[model samples]
Target: MLKPQMSPTRELISLDGLWAFDIERDSRPQAWTGTLDSGLEAAVPASYNDLFVDSAIRDHVGWAWYQRKVCVPRRWTSDRIFLRVDAATHEGRVYVNDSFVGQHIGGYTPFEMDITDLVAPGEEFRLTIGVNNELTNITIPPGSITVAQDGRRQQKYLHDFYNYAGLSRSVWLYSAPQQRVEDITVVTDIEGTTGVVTYDVQASAPSTVRVRALDASGTQVAEAEGAAGTLRIEAANLWKPGAAYLYNLVAEIVDNGEVIDSYTQTFGVRTVEVRGAEFLINGEPFYFTGFGKHEDSPVRGKGHDDAYLVHDFQLLEWVGANSFRTSHYPYAEEVMDFADRHGIVVIDETAAVGLNLAVQGGLAGGATTPTFSPETFNDDTQAAHAQAIRELIARDKNHPSVVMWCIANEPSSNEEGAREYFAPLVELTRTLDPTRPVTYAVVMFATFKNDRIADLFDVMCLNRYYGWYVATGDLATAETYLKGELQGWVDKFGKPIMMAEYGADTLPGLHSVWDMPWTEEYQADYLDMNHRVFDSIPSFVGEQVWNFADFQTSNGIHRVDGNRKGVFTRDRKPKSAAHALRTRWRGLENQKPGTSN
Candidate 1:
């Protein structure tokens, strides 16, 4: 799952631009026919939903085709070419010049096809990619589709976010040598003044491996000669919050002292752990101050935009924040890379949202059903969930910014069969990567008293809306209830607690003198109340607000345009709550553990 990069022994090309787009209305199987017949064109590397004015296009449920004719470089004749799709929403199928090459399930993670035998260099071929936006009971983020009398398939799910689907990430055409480095796994550690990097390289053939660690200035600090060995640096510069320092690890496969393959991996030397009532980074307690963010913006929907990404990180830094959670799904790799370079801590999560049937029923006033019933999220769902965990760990295991792995968000931890469902997943995460802690965000219904899976996690990540959802604008009672609930958590389990989500939906410029929900003043006041309770609890280690910005959601009466819980608007304009957070977080920017600003 190594990201495609340009190196001395590798060639890269971006297959990003306008592509022939058309909808597949019938459920019948369709094969690639070299070119799409439809006249509609859509941009690659973006969600096709918001780019069109047609509602049918925006709400497309089944398969869609994106075809682009590309030319392979003649110089890549001796190399094995690859077609790497950074991401395909839910499912994707690849075709080379008219024949199917490969397919992959799971939306957020990357998948590639080695198409060396399918196409020839110095020639043009029609590259077609079919993307499906369907989700069923067995999918990671489970959903259902029901056909109406008019034969229209409507999608229903437990999550509140919109199903903006397409190839929202980059597509790459890269070349690698026949005997190239296949994969590399790196684990970092710090010992007093020395930085330790232990690496394992997987190559295609038996070759001499040489590893070099270079500082930010491109000077070699350490070198080792092995496929698996450690590079120790004296007086190492540690990667800290707000002060990121990266050391590039260059791994090479040498044949008779001549390099045959080379790849560079940028990594930060850091360590994460959970000890009693504290979440420590680099052997020191680190407090988190940020928000639960989404890959959302105006027009782009869930598309990955470089401008939006840079601006969002700037805003996070401007607000004096150091961390954020990839709320419900794994975001684009570019987002993760930015976080790594900028020293932003991340709670990397899977798309295991909407697993709770009760939450969906509550949100829509529907009949509640057992979440883990035979007809619902059962064995097949568990298998899909397990696969999601495997892919997530394989993709993001080496990221220094990812301090924790959030397996699921807002699952029905209080329901029956909850323990059986998540217990093994938690154990699986630890078995895969024993470096960091594992957690799942707790819904408001899954309290400390009734939650069955909280004990399995290392940190208790609670997403509660005390004043908004429970007390309904009653700040005083909200504060009291919040404190009591948090105290119950501390008394029940002496683990460190983090407020993974807490916010009031506030419309921009909507001012009210009194404590009213949806008003700017109320959102600010609600956060203040929650902060007071967090400070009162000894186990509280972090506070990530519900959202970083307003985002699109499915059509519902509860949502106006979309979720307004963001401290900033969808266009990156700050709401009043943003200023309030800035003032508070600025003071707590350097606050030590167990101390108030």
Candidate 2:
């Protein structure tokens, strides 16, 4: 799960431009060996669904093909060559010169295959990657596919976000030595003014290992000569919210005093814990003030773009926020690296967004049924969920910016068998990485009275749409109900509560003096009401609104274009609710410690 980087011993080439693409139809053979027959091209590092104007292509189910030709570098003959796909939607299979190589199931994580023996240096080979967008009951983010009367396959899921699919991230061809650093795990702590970083390295083979801890100025602060050891820094600069400082931990493989491979991992010296009703970072009470975000844009559709990435963080800074959640899925690795450099807190989440049958029924217009039955989200689904947690932690455990792990979002905690389904998963997450808190976004239906798995989590991340979905424009009743429910959680669980998602959908230009729904004025008023309740509860630790910006969703009458609960519009334009948040958060920023909001 180590991110590919270029060093003196390693080289990287980005396969991130136009590639030949086609869709499978009527049991067509895969374009594995020769050039694709469609003669159509699609951009890499982007979803193919939004790139075309054809409705059939936009809504196509099943698999799509992307093929390109790559020349192996001449110098890479002596090194091990790898073909790395950052992500391939739900499932991806790779073929090199018509020979099947490797495949991976997870859509949001990385997968790689060693191709040194398959091709020679200074030679060209056809690289074909097939991505399947279909999700079934066994997938991590479960969905059901049915054949319509017209004989076309249709995909339906419980999640509200659009199921954008394809090669939504970068693909790379890289080289490394036969004996090199495989993985690096760093756990950081602070004892008084000194920062302690304990690291463990996994190598391809047995070799003498050298580790060095260097500061921002490239001065070596500490060094060790083992595969696993600790580095201590005197007067260490701690990485805090809104103030980031990083140390580079370099690992080198030495064979007879000659360096064969080198890799550097950037990490921050920080610690996170949930003690009683307070969420602490670096042993200080910390508040989360941000939004639940998605890797979505106009045409890219979850593609990782540098321009959008920088701009989104800039917007988060402009809004006077300190934290955000990767709402319903694990985002690109580049996003986590940026957060680490910028000192923004993250609640890392898995792609377990659609596990609730009741929520799916309400949104997708289906009959409510037991969600955890054998035919639905059963043992296979739990196995996939366990793998999702494993990959997520393995990829993100070293990040200081990620303080908590959100295992699922708005699952059916009120349904039968909820406890049986979620208990082992929560235990697995804690076993993977014991440093971070564990939580799941609770739907309004899963309340203190009926929620079976609330006690399994360390924090209560409640996603309640009281005014928008329940009360429907009645703020007075919404406020009362919200306060009562929050009080119930505090009384029952005695844990820190966070309003992980709460907002009203509002059109940009819509206006109403009476504060009607879908108006900018009502969105602002709804936020104020939620904040009043948050300030009154000592156990309420944070507030991240429903969304950072409007995003695309499956077509339905409940959505106009997409979900409009974002404080900012789809294009990063701030709505009136954004101004309200700034006014409150900025004041909190200037408020003295121990003072009330």
Candidate 1 lDDT over residue span 1-597, tens digit each = 899999999989999989999889666495666568789999888899999999889888899999988999999989999999988998999999878998989989999999999888899898999998999999978899988798888888778898888899999999999999988999999888899999999998888999999999999999999899999999998877777789999999999889999999988898898999999988989899999999988777787889989999999988878899998899999998998889889999999998888875663324368888889999899999999999999899888989999999998888889999989899999999999999999988888888888989899999999999888989999998999999999999999998999999999988999999999999999999999888777678999998899999999898999999999998889998899999989887555551122
In model 1, which residue pairs have backbone atoms overlapping below 3 Å? none
Q: Rate the local accuracy (lDDT) of all candidates.
A: 0.90, 0.90
User: Per-residue lDDT of 1-597 in model 2, one digit per residue for the tens?
Assistant: 799999889999999999999888766654355677797889999999999987888899988999999999988878999999999999999999889898899899899999888989999999999999989989989899999999999999888899999999999999999999999999999999999999999999987899999999999999999999999998999988888899999999998889999999999998899999999988888888999999999999988899999999998888888889998899999999999999899999999988988875663324367889998899999999999999999999989899999999988888888899999999999998988999999987888998899999999999988888888899999999999999999999899999999989999999999959999999999999999999899877899988899999999998999999899898999999999888888887765231121
Point out where model 2 deviates above 4 Å: 29-31, 360-367, 592-597
TM-scores of the candidates are 0.98, 0.98
Q: Each model's RMSD to truth, in Å?
A: 1.6, 1.9
Name the candidate that leads on lDDT.
2
